[model samples]
Target: MMKKPAMQKSKQWNIKGAVHLAGIFHFLHSCGSGCLVPFLTLYFRHLGLTATMTGIIMASKHLLALVWRPISSVLARQYDKRRTVIVGSLLSSALVVLLLLLFPSAGIKAESGRCNTSQPSADPTDGSDFTTLESINIPSQSNANVYSVNHKTIITEQPDELSSTYTPTLVNSSSNWSIRAIRSLRNLEEQQEEAPHTEFLGSLKVMDAQQQMFFLVLFVIVLWEFMAAPLEWTADDGLYEYLDFVDATGRHKGVKVWKQLGAAVGTGMVGILVTKLYCRTGTVTEFYSYTALMILTAPTAALFPLYLRKRERATSGGFKALQLVYGNSQALLCAITVVLTGMATSAVSDFLLWQMQDHNAMEIHMGISLALAYLSQAGFAPLAGRLARFLKYHGWLMVLAVISLSLQCLYYSFLWGPWAVVPAQMLAGFSTGALWWSVTSQCEDIATPGTEVTLIRLFEALSLELGAGLGSLMVGFVVQKFGLKILFQGISVILALWSIALAVLKWKIPRQRRINYSRLLAADTSEVSESESDQEKDWLETAMEDARQGNKWKMDKF
Candidate 1:
């Protein structure tokens, strides 16, 4: 008896150690991702790509990333490879970034004199019409580089951090691309009056060499996301499996909180680092930080504990994982909501920093604002479950999330200065995290017992990549055409309509459970025709048993 008790205690210790390890690894992994992902759009913009092109690239990259995630999750659970594969993915992803850094940046011709102080002064009337560069360590641009962004007249160079996948930046290119770009556009009569109105966004011909350079760099970034895929879903799947094995499932929230907090800290650290460093080296420093953080994330992943269960893998199982298993009304509605949420997320993730730069917000301000968003994410993650339970699955929370996100997007339109981001982003967690929580609850409530992990990852990719990718395409083109403010306001209006539509659907459509076709098909009607014989009873019983056992949906009484 004493031996049995001692053995149980030792086993308990091992489980505890494993959970702690999982939490630590997640924290570090989130830290690495936070350092660069939030600012990726700004980086592309600085490279002279228009928002439209940026969105196209982002959409393609996200689509590819989506493909990788499902495969990664399947492998993690089916093959029990999450432990080693997660680490391998992280290391390989870091290597890709290292390669990205080594590839020389193209078309950025930096020269000595400040963005030609000799040019005509910009109009003072337009509050939104501030140059991307003022006096602060602005980089000189080649005319080719400036013309490559969507064709707007008010030419300006971006700050170096212009953009971390931007620390987009406080450092200016010493080059004079902005000046020549302004002059070139001014010479065109059709575009002259609209120049200041279009302001920082000016169109360059698609055939420009600078434009082509953007595609080249985008390809490399896409590859990085592909390699990073295994780290995203696979890591979470492994950790969840580990938790289930040890009966420590409740610890999942704590792990998420740690992950959010780590991201908050990492973004804030980058903000402060950008501030303390010279403008010239700010973006370079960001790349180094990004590369180093990802590298550091690798070792912790190597230590991640994944408990792979013995299971049969087949084509049917893989296909099932990808299919929608919930009711038609609710599942489809939630999927739409998730996509809308993705659009909002992608717009904010890619362009919020660009707007801040347009408003002359410092690089540090951009960093801290993003950090605050993560902090809000950490705070709300714990409360999400409670919020969902209190609402009782009516999807009221999801509607609220849509409204909140729309309001958040709308608020960006009214920002007068850099300080505006703080208030706009502080409550961001509510809109994003809440929608995700409510959508995820739908998946959890209906998921077949053993396939919960696969289902959750499937939905996650839909929201994170599919929705976001489509949103990127929309936001980028809109911003390029109408400028940032109009684009934000338009998205807000669309989301408002979406929220109202969702509310109408919820009010009209009654809650229905996922239909069990097997059970329904197996129901007997023999009693209505005649008294059952012994053979008939046995056939009915066998069919019922097979239905209960989760066999084919079609049942034959004969």
Candidate 2:
């Protein structure tokens, strides 16, 4: 009797220590990618890719996740190699950053030679400063990348100010190009008279260089997504397995708050690094920081422990996770809700930076806003579990998340300047922190016991990726045709309506507390026949037996 009590005490201590160690790894992993992921759109635009092109490349991540994530999860499950996958994925992420670093960059500032230089603010009444400045950089040589100030030009050729990592923006007919347009045209004509062929050749070279960079960036992103697809799901799946081992899954949300904290630190660090060095830095600071952090965490991931129970159940070998989604209406609804909300959320994640750029928001504004947003998530994440209790149903949490997504779109739609992003993003923190907690936790609750291979059900994540990819691909076109402001407003309205549809559908469809652990894995598309069902027992019965065995054997130690 005394030995039994002593063993229980020792086991409790072991679980406590194990979870804290796990939190440290989670913190480092979140910090690693937080440094660069948020700023990627700005990075692409700086490289002279059009908005539509950037969107397609960004969207490829989610679209590709459909293939790679599943494959990664299966590989991890079969080989019991979750730790190996995590380590490999993190190292791959670091390599991707190093490859991106080989290209010259200067924060998010436009490179001097690129045609997308920011024009100086002019008093519309005077117009002289704008006109004269536009003529000075009118390419004494023909190096046209097709951007002009109202078909005019602009200048700031200081080597320190014009590093290759600068963003060049499009100028439309609506731009304030008056005397500057005329002066730029006159200078261009004279320059062309002297060396027309030379200018033409230079333009060809510039366009060729831009094209090369565009393709290179796209290729890098594609490879990066494929290699890193396993990182999050694999890591989180391992974490969940560990939690279940200790019977401490309740503390999962509270521990995950550490991730938000680490992300806040990393994002704040890089945001400050980039914003402060917008002119002085020759290298992309975020990549260096991101690489260092990823390297820092890879070793921990390699050694992380995972729990893989023996397949003692009769219905073991098939895609039971898939059948859960198809047979259950509530689970299916959860998938749909996640996908639609994922698309709406993409408006803020992928393209909000474009809107901020249009408002002349500086790096500091971007950095500070996003950092605070992350911090807000960290602050609020612990409360989500309690809030779910008050809200009664976990599904209500989804409705709240949808509402938050809609409000975020509405805020960005009417943004006046960069400073507003700071406050607006605070709400984003809750959406990601509390709301995201709600999204994943609710799905976790809905899944049948012992079917987890990737934290949430596989279909839940797939639906999310599908929504995000579709959103990014289509949102790019809207930004191209209607502009960023109009795009946000439209998305806000559409998402508002979507939230209502979800609420109504959720009301009508009953939530599936635990899906039937079916015996007919081979006939996933077909219903289980009574005769076949009679031969087999529900997975929960086996899971209970496994639990008794696990307690008796004390871990079935891998």
Candidate 3:
């Protein structure tokens, strides 16, 4: 008996160790991707890509991940999860290295001598004779060379040859010559005179080479994104597994706390590093190098979970497991809620920078707002967890999240100043933090007993990714069309409707309490089919006998 207790204690310790390891992995991964990926658009802009093109590149990653997540779920089910995680991590790290190597840090250099040096000549057809055209000397304080032209003939003079005189040969234009024709002739003369000196062959070749390199680097980054998709799903699955273990030991909140704390520290570190390294140095390569190092370290942290003795329960395999969970109406409703939550959350996240910029916020102020947003999330996550426990209804917690998110949308729509938005970000933090925790907890509750937790987590992850991808993609276009203020208003209205749908679902669907199937199966030794039929017959016979006795009693009383 003592040995059994000792083993149980050891198992608990191992489980806790695994949870901490997972948190560390989350931290490292967050530090890497979170810090740098958000700046990818800025990097592209620096490379002379337009905003529309940059948006397409960034949105493509999420769009591809949306499809990759389902495949990742299947792969996780088919393979050893530990191996899958290791492979995913290794591939992600390798991809990061490749991306850094391919990234175009040195932007295209501007070519010298490209500016047109010739001055605009007045048309002689505008009632001006050739003899009256004196050499006009426009005084420029700058050191740039200036050229003056004669109307009747092509006379070219270098800046140093300003003192040289030229006699103009008169050419009479017929009265039929239109103003357009004369203007075209003047433009042709200017082009012909400046063409030789303005064209720099070496610079042209270099710029073309840089453009090709930029596109190649972009293609590699997209490929890297495709490969990184599975890693995200595997990590979340591992987290859910850890949550299950900790919940069994009645320390689930501790897991959430550690995860949130890690995320907070990681997010804070990103702000600090970006300010210190990127802002101070202004070197893109240095930033990439730091991000690459962080990503490479994540795999090693992920390996710690494999050392834990605790193993995830085996899945039932195939679409059967998915159907079992998603077949239920309540589960379907919960999924819809999750997707809407994701849509709203992602829209706000993708647009916050733009919103701040519209309000004329400085770069430092924008950074502060983002930092506060992330910190608030980290700080409020555990508190939200406790609030959920206090309420004892995860659904209500989701409602609270929705309400908080609604308020956040409203706050962002009507911003007073940049500093004012920082305090408002706390509401966003609460909403995001609460929604994430509540959704996961609720998923566990609704998941069928004996079903693999990974499957449920996968579904949750898919909903989030799909919603976020679609939201980011669509909201970007919507903002482009309708402007930011209108976009926020539209999002606010949609969230309100989503909240109503959730409330209706909550009212209609009965809450599912977790059932211990192991204890239930162990308690019943007899064959279910044989006992069930006999019990049904006996119940019918007893009901008939009771009816007869009631009739006899009624007759005697009468």
Candidate 4:
């Protein structure tokens, strides 16, 4: 048996190993998936496809998920989380690689029939091949092989076409090869001009129309994951708008336009730090601390769980770890909250604008709201990951969200005009950024028994997508029927109640008791027996032996 100190050391090492693995896993997935959001539409345009088609194709991911979620959840619950993760990652990656490879070939085929180079061949023996030769020489039949004429060089001719005094003559082919070549060249030039101006779009231009469509679909799904879905279901939207108000108000004219530039510098700095620290520390503590910093900031930070889920699958195939942490119940609850809150908020906003019979006024409010919405989601995603690490639980985070949203709504309702949303935006920024990260972290933290990470993630994903789709549709119906105040009032009540529910849940699962070992380790033995690879078992055994030999400590908490 291992000594006490050795056991402690082993536990510590395991937790650290798991955390580090999780962090790296999250980062890579986020980078790959998130990069597409800002560029997908342009990619579609490059393929000469329409926006309507783009939207339908993009929306299909969610539709596909409707099928995938239940199946994924059941499989994850029954099988290994890691295997599920591997399957999902491989599925997505294979599709991506296939698309990249398939695009160019498809594009070439698309251009194939439209362009060609060869001209029809002519036969010299054909009657049509012989045009009347006005200037010709006749040669004696006996001298057909070699004929000569006065002041003329000796020439040879076929026996059938003997000419004495033979003079050299040239015949132009029936077709103007040069003119056809020029026209062909001109067509090529026009194609070059009309090939959708793909240069500015980079390599995506080389992709085929179907691949472009695929890309648009995948990208929109990714965006919905990061944007409309997460916020609509969670209490984060209020925070997002509020923060946008802050950033907008905080900046002057030039700063707002150049905001992404500033963001670029900041992102670069964070990337460097993440790379450096992940390389050196390679521990959960290091990963969490770094993630905390990003999460608290909002946008990039908000993307933490997504980053974690994808990366974990990519690197370790540890989808089970995620499943053990956040299960179906929590996912269902989160989905309910998202749908209800999104519907309430959107309906309220629409009703209020309609009450005034001011469509333009509503549009202005929504425009600012939409812009702010986009800014926080796009700008602070990395920061949100960092914040999630810092905060630890959704319950405490929810309190903060409620307070910030309440303040912003009060401003919008009474204290401020549409412009008043500016100062209140900061509250939104903080809440949204933190809320996004915290919710994901909590979901990961509270997985129920036998849940796989993939199942949890898919459910989380489906909830967000379905919720947003439902919210948009439902809110439209409500606003058309009811007045604006009623909508706002309903949203306020639902948001407040969501805050309460979260607070209660948090009270039951505090920071100290955050980790749920029962769920996490519930099927530890069975999992080890069935799925743990020989290599993984050997590593664990070595770690255990090291602890027994007084070289390491037990590591249980991660």
RMSD of each: 12.8, 12.8, 14.4, 24.2
Across 289-323, the per-residue lDDT of candidate 3 in tens digits comes to 44564557656554745323343454444356557
Ten residues in sequence with the least summed lDDT for candidate 3: 127-136
- Give candidate 4 misplaced runs (Cα > 4 Å): 1-335, 342-369, 377-394, 402-420, 446-456, 509-558
After superposition, which runs of candidate 3 have C-alpha atoms over 4 Å from their true positions? 1-16, 41-55, 69-218, 235-259, 276-280, 283-286, 289-292, 295-299, 307-321, 360-364, 385-392, 512-558
TM-score of each: 0.72, 0.69, 0.62, 0.34
> Over all chains combined, what TM-score does candidate 3 have?
0.62
Question: Could you tell me which residue pairs clash in candidate 2?
Answer: 109-166, 110-166, 110-167, 111-166, 112-162, 116-168
Local error of candidate 3 at residue 358 (angstroms) = 3.6
Question: Which of candidates 3 and 4 reaches a greater lDDT?
Answer: 3
Q: Sort by lDDT, best first: what order?
A: 1, 2, 3, 4
lDDT of 2: 0.67
Query: Model 2: per-residue lDDT, tens digit, 108-154?
Result: 33434223237655565432222222122334345343434433543
Q: Which tens-of-lDDT digit does each residue in 200-299 have in candidate 4? A: 7745654433555456555645533322222211212122222333332111112222333333333333334433443232212222332343233233
- Give the 10-residue window scoring lowest on summed lDDT in candidate 4: 105-114
The reply for model 2, stretches above 4 Å from the true place, is 1-13, 104-209, 246-251, 307-318, 452-460, 511-558
